[model samples]
Target: MEKEYTIRELTKLCHETAQEKGFWDEKRNIGEALMLIVTELAEAMEAHRIQDQANFKEELADTFIRLFDLCGGLEIDIQEEIDKKAQRNKQRPYKHGKIC
Candidate 1:
């Protein structure tokens, strides 16, 4: 049977690979990781704008990878936080103060 990987497991793998590559060195900071996440978001946006399905998918993956790496580095329980946020959102009003 194939093993199903959890978010935490994937994040740990990404963090380990980053460390091996020297990208997650002692000099690296959360701010830098966050900016890289933002950069990936921008790439995703551009891909969407250009209607490039492949690039869009790749960029989206990159964004998630960066996010996971950041969470791992910070030792954050992202799954718990996501669950809490989702539960809190359930109590929010429809559209939640949005104009749309």
Candidate 2:
């Protein structure tokens, strides 16, 4: 049987692949990539909503792939970073914090 990755594993895969491509935060165009995805989501939600299951999955996968690229471009190990940040947030007590 083929192996399946959990969400965290997939994220790690993206991070590792990013390293192969030499992603550096200094050279990333984060705003552009973010804008593109945001635009796609907005248009997709506003227009068809894509009721077709296969099509929806494809769109979702494309979105995540772009996000992975963005993470690579920013030189961020998203899974580790998110985990670290979550731990830091847990250590700090904020009544109205939105860091995560």
Candidate 3:
């Protein structure tokens, strides 16, 4: 069977896996989500400074995976949000970029 899964579907799988593995509980998973993202991002930045290939790739994947899990647990529509954010960013100019 030629099967395909949407981002939402795949994200839900991550959530399920997390629940089964005790990575999350009955409530929201935002705590774990933020930890996974921020920590990995910091680690990735350090890895980039020293050019650590394995840790960089691992951090990148881990950050993305946590984002997926967060979306699944929070029922966030990421694709539509990304599209909206893209349009918003387009409307902003380099002036704001410098100010911010």
- Per-candidate clashes come to 0, 0, 0
- For each candidate in turn, the TM-score is 0.85, 0.54, 0.72
Q: Higher TM-score: candidate 2 or 3?
A: 3
lDDT of 1 at 89: 97
Q: lDDT per residue, candidate 2, 17-77, as tens digits?
A: 7667666435557787788768766655644465665666666666676677676556567
Ranking by lDDT: 1, 3, 2
Error in Å for residue 100 of model 2: 19
Which parts of model 2 have CA positions greater than 4 angstroms off? 5-28, 43-50, 85-100
> Model 2 Cα displacement at 38 (Å)?
1.6
Question: What is the C-alpha lDDT profile of model 1 across 1-100, one tens digit per residue?
Answer: 9988888797898777777888866767778889999999999999999999999999999998888877887889787888899999999988996888
Q: For residues 1-100, what per-residue lDDT tens digits would candidate 3 score against the true structure?
A: 8668776676887778877888665665567668868998998899999999899998887777778778877888776787899899889988757955
Error of 3 at 61 (Å): 1.0
Model 3: how large is the Cα RMSD against the reference?
3.3
If ranked by TM-score, best first, what sequence of candidates would result? 1, 3, 2
| Prediction 3 global C-alpha lDDT | 0.79
* Model 2 backbone overlap count: 0
